[model samples]
Target chain A: MKKTVNQKAWFMVLPVLLLVAFSAVIPLMTVVNYSVQDTFGNNEFFWVGLEWFEEIIQSERMHDALIRQILFSSIILIIEIPLGIFIALHMPKKNSLWTSLCLVLIALPLLIPWNVVGTIWQIFSRIDIGLLGYSLDAIGVDYNYTQNAVDAWITIIIMDVWHWTSLVVLLCYAGLQSIPDAYYQAAKIDQASRWNTFRYIELPKMKGVLLIAILLRFMDSFMIYTEPFVVTGGGPGNATTFLSIDLVKMAIGQFDLGPAAAFSLIYFLVILLISWVFYTAMIHTDEENQS
Target chain B: MRISRSNWIMILYILFLMLPIYWLVNMSLKSNQEILDGFSLWPQAITFDNYMTIFTDSSWYMGYVNSIIYVVINTIISLTVALPAAYAFSRYRFMGDKHLFFWLLSNRMAPPAVFALPFFQLYSSVGLFDTHIAVALAHTLFNVPLAVWILEGFMRGVPKEIDETAYIDGYGFFRFFGKIFVPLIASGIGVTAFFCFMFSWVELLLSRTLTAVDAKSIAATMTRTVSASGVDWGVLAAAGVLTIIPGALVIYFVRNHIAKGFALGRV
Candidate 1:
């Protein structure tokens, strides 16, 4: 369908533009202002052109937090994507009381507030009184998230997987449902093996939604804060302190406004650059599929 | 009938999903002493005092009221603004449209932590601090983009002929949209609102930072319980259960829409 070139459409878009400007663009400018200026007590300010940015760029702590953030996001994507796909493949295909019950139950975790998710796992993984901790101890694994960094990492990773894998499943399931029965009937007539059918048919069909699911998962996991903060408080000694937690610690905990502002600009740029790359790649693939 | 391997995988996966939740619910039902006594699969002595406390206590119950008010305001504002913008993106070819769409999505990528301090300063300076509207506006920084994206996909799935036919029949754009286009895409609006509500409801950082006393969110209130007694285990667990209730209710109503196809049949 060819759309008309009408500049009147700009009027339709103005409200969104004004709203986002107030909510996003203005605060962003404030951060940019802070990034380049030095502030003293009593609302006095001085010029500090790129000094804070240079310090943050060279800081060892920022490097560690960035690396840790990348590792956590990668682990989450790797685990959740495949696991979600597998679960969606086996979910009951038709609408039934059983299927609805399963869908509702599976979706329960996602609805809980982020802090509560952290709190639930905090208590659930406690060795003295929690079910997971006691069961693991009973089986003799020597588990303790508080005293050990490795255990803390494992606990956070598992908590994230438990909290978010359902999102991927729900996205993939929605993708799977969009396929009309005609495609499968044609596949059956061709006697296509299950693996071949999935590879050639279902996979291609799910590409659009899968891209969306991956992007959403990546952004959320990369910027994760509340759950891990509540669970481990960035501890067992900075083991689970990702970039957001680190930024909060610097800006709020230490009250270093200039450095924190510079840190945020860099962090926001990284997300924008990566997401731009992803956005372009998706558009390219979409064009390819079209042609 | 023989059970397939995939069926076993899904059942085990669901069990894994339920385990922590079951633990929370089990904890919510037990006495504080019983909760710390030991690990039990089920509450040995069932009790509702934890829930009773949440209902009877003003501070606790007020948190829920504040959360609901702001979240509803956010959803309504997001949908109202996004609907026209989404319709334009779906139906018209305007200048910088592609770039505009991507830019909006990038806002969704902005880290909430980065904006926490700036939002605090901005809201306080403007006198919108400690109000429900402030958080609602802040959430639109993310939720509006999402609503537009989801709604645009659904609107594009709708054929252009409907718009043309309605216009050809002498109906105004607004009337046609409200009477025909909206009902045709009711499921899409349902999904979009569900997502907006979900993100706004679960978010802690901006909502907590932007409000102090009058509009403090339930998540922020729950955090205070943690610092209050060091471990108000049973009460915290009960609060956690109550927080999940609204999301569950929202999902129950939209489950079919989500399960159907995410309202994006054309794409």
Candidate 2:
């Protein structure tokens, strides 16, 4: 699709620009201001000039949280992406009542409030009352999210997989549905195995959507807060405290605005840098495929 | 005839998806005593008292009202701003367009945790604190970018000849858009609105930060159920159940369009 070069299109984009500036830009500038300044009570402030950034960069807590955050995101991408693709492959491809039913059920978790999702798992996995915990105990397995660090990590990961895997499934399912029946017919004529059909036909066609799914999952998992906050409160001695959880505790809980602001900038920068790399890499591959 | 292995897999996966939700519904129907007593496959003494309490309590029900109001407002605002921008991006290449587009997407990637405190002060200083519109406007930070991205994907599929044809037929830009172009991408709009509504509705950090009492979201309000005495497990479960209703309804209404929407749109 060749697009005309039209500077007048800027007029069309103006409204979104103004709205985003109001909502995102001004607050961002405030974070920048706070990052560089030292402030006491009663709104009194002094110029601190990168002191907060220096301290944050040197902080052990920040380092631990960053490592934990990266680990959590990696685990999430690993589990959810393949699982989602598998489920999408098995989903009813034909338009029927069953397809709609499957879609609605698959999407249910995604629509629930983030905290509610946490609450659901919190209840469903409690040792005293949760179904999973009670059953696990009955089976002679030791498991308690509130008391065990490994258990806490497991619960958070499972909860995330339950909450978000549907997104991947839906995106992949859409990609799958767009493949014409003729492709499968050609595969059948060639006596291709299931793996061969999936590899050559499905995988190539699904690349665009797969990239989008991966990017979304990465960003969202990196910034996850509410569910983990509600479920564990980043507790068991900060075992599950991802960066956002740690930042909120610092900024809101302890009122360490300057350090928290600096932390926020670094956190945002990490996401920006990684996503830029991802975007360019995916787009480059897409162009290569086209040629 | 026996079910195929693929059918069995599908059934098992759906069951896995529904198990937690089923537990929530089961808990919602049981008494607090029944829940704490032990885990049961079904509610032993099924009760609607929890639902009754939520309906009769202003604090409980108003949370739902507030959430719905802000989500609706945010969707409308996002779509209104995004539609033209999406059209512009889809149809024309302007200066810094790629950079501008990426910049918009970066906002979607921004962590709400980072924005929570600044938004608190930003809303507070503007006297928009504790208002529904405050959360609505704050949500636009992410939702607008997403709405634009999704809508742009759908709009790009429309042939360029349609616009030229409309102009040649003497249809004005606004007239052409409202009359022909919008209807063409109606499902796309539905999907974009659904995504905007879903994100805004589910988001807790910004919504909780921007509003305190007058406009607290249901998600934020659910936090209050955990008191020193103990959590109101039944009522809490009921509130969670109620929160899912609107979303379920929306999904049902948009069921057919969803696949097509995603197939065409960028989301």
Highest lDDT against the true fold, candidate: 2
Candidate 1 local lDDT, A68-108, one digit each (tens): 99999999999999988888898888889868877887787
- Candidate 2 regions exceeding 4 Å error are A285-291, B263-267
Q: What are the lDDT figures for the candidates, one per model? A: 0.90, 0.91
Best by DockQ: 2
DockQ of each: 0.73, 0.77
lDDT of 1 by residue, B95-187 (tens): 999999999999999999999999999999999999999999999999999999889888877889999999999999889999999999998
- lDDT of candidate 2 over B11-85, digit per residue (tens): 998888788888889999999999988778899889999999999999989999999999999999999999999
State each model's C-alpha RMSD to the native: 1.5, 1.3
Query: Which pairs of residues collide in candidate 1?
Result: none
Give the Å shift of residue A133 in candidate 1. 1.1
How close to the true structure is residue B81 of candidate 1, measured as C-alpha lDDT? 99
The TM-score measured for candidate 1 stands at 0.97
| Model 2 lDDT tens row, A149-231 | 99999999999999999999898998898899999999999999999999999998888888888888999999999999999
